[model samples]
Target: MNAPDDTLEFTGGLVARLPEPADFGIALAEGFARRIGDLSRRAGAPAAAARWAARAAFAA
Candidate 1:
């Protein structure tokens, strides 16, 4: 395993536009939830239906 380094290195010059952090986090969470639901449906287990139901509740 690689040891954790605490040094701050500015190697890459990447411009970030983070005006709305909340919106970004919400979008990220929504994407992750959708992916989980899709994977559950594909797996076709007993919990798959619950996953879809959760998606519907959160989406609406």
Candidate 2:
């Protein structure tokens, strides 16, 4: 993926494409929302999906 202007360029051609510092929460929330939605469909439980997503997000 192409890195945005504000993102940091790392070694080994890996790019970290993060939103602005002010928008970090919004970005993280959006990702969590999407992941929860996907996991809910597969797991059939919103609470479990959210728990799994929370763990994964925290680990990341």
Candidate 3:
């Protein structure tokens, strides 16, 4: 997924194709977890999904 030019790229390879925290226009951690949770659920990425689930349990 191509991110906006203003956002930092995920070169670390922890979770790929995640939207930048700023994209959600909310708290950094919460936004990161929310986007990852949704993406992982759709992409069937179990590791990322698990992290998202644990970090953002309220969102799920």
Candidate 4:
């Protein structure tokens, strides 16, 4: 997936090292949110998905 200009890309090699489907899903979700956060910052929108990621971290 393409990361925003402000963010580093999530490399395929790194994703390949994930251990399981659930873990992969969470990582993918978080990574996507991080990219969104970068985009939001650029556009002056709210980082709502980053809040979701924060809640997810507390749930972990």
Candidate 5:
């Protein structure tokens, strides 16, 4: 479903005003979390991988 115009405008403006350093920190953390998930999957640890992926999605 499409967001209402005012809601879209407010969210778009909010995102546009976020600090660059915060974005960089989030990207770095997300990349590290995803890498952990990948390694866990490669090591045949599905439970660990799933947990890491969930953490990444929740935290990031």
Candidate 6:
């Protein structure tokens, strides 16, 4: 995914935008979450899917 071009203006007039590295990290985390959730459900642990998905995402 492409990083947004929008910038945040600070009190001192400093402009900040989402860095490419951070954007990629966020995308990866999202992918991990989805995959973990799917795997958990497929293993017949739907009840714990959300919890495990969260753990996997953060542990990455």
- Global lDDT scores for all candidate models: 0.44, 0.47, 0.47, 0.49, 0.49, 0.50
Which tens-of-lDDT digit does each residue in 26-58 have in candidate 4?
466556656555665667656665555444442
**12-46: candidate 5 lDDT, tens digit per residue:** 43323457655554445544555666676777888
TM-score of each: 0.44, 0.38, 0.33, 0.41, 0.50, 0.50
Which predicted model would earn the best lDDT? 6
lDDT of 3: 0.47
Query: What is every candidate's alpha-carbon RMSD to the true fold?
Result: 12.1, 11.0, 10.7, 7.0, 9.5, 9.2
Better structure of 3 and 4 per lDDT: 4
Which portions of model 3 miss their true places by more than 4 Å?
1-26, 45-60
Give the C-alpha miss distance for residue 47 in model 4, angstroms: 6.8
Q: Please write out the lDDT profile of model 1 over residues 1-60, one tens digit for every residue.
A: 111142112211111222454445444544455565666667774675846644664354
By summed lDDT, which 10 consecutive residues of candidate 1 come out lowest? 6-15
Which of 1 and 2 is the better model by TM-score? 1
After TM-score superposition, what is the CA distance of residue 10 in candidate 6 from its true location, in Å?
Answer: 27
Candidate 4: 10-residue stretch with minimal lDDT? 2-11
1-60 in candidate 6: lDDT tens per residue? 553342111111112234656656654555565566667777778656665664566457
- Candidate 6 regions with alpha-carbon error over 4 angstroms: 2-19
Name the candidate, 1 or 5, with the larger TM-score value.
5
Off by over 4 Å in 4: 1-19, 46-60
At residue 53, candidate 1 shows an lDDT of 47
Clashes of each: 0, 0, 0, 0, 0, 0
What is the per-residue lDDT of model 3 for residues 1-60, given as tens digits with 9 covering 90 to 100? 333343322223222345665334333434465566667677776875556463664244
| Residue ranges of candidate 2 with Cα displaced over 4 Å | 1-19, 44-60
- In model 2, residue pairs whose N, Cα or C atoms come closer than 3 Å (at least 3 residues apart or on different chains), thus clashing, are none
Cα lDDT for residue 39, candidate 4: 63
TM-score of 6: 0.50
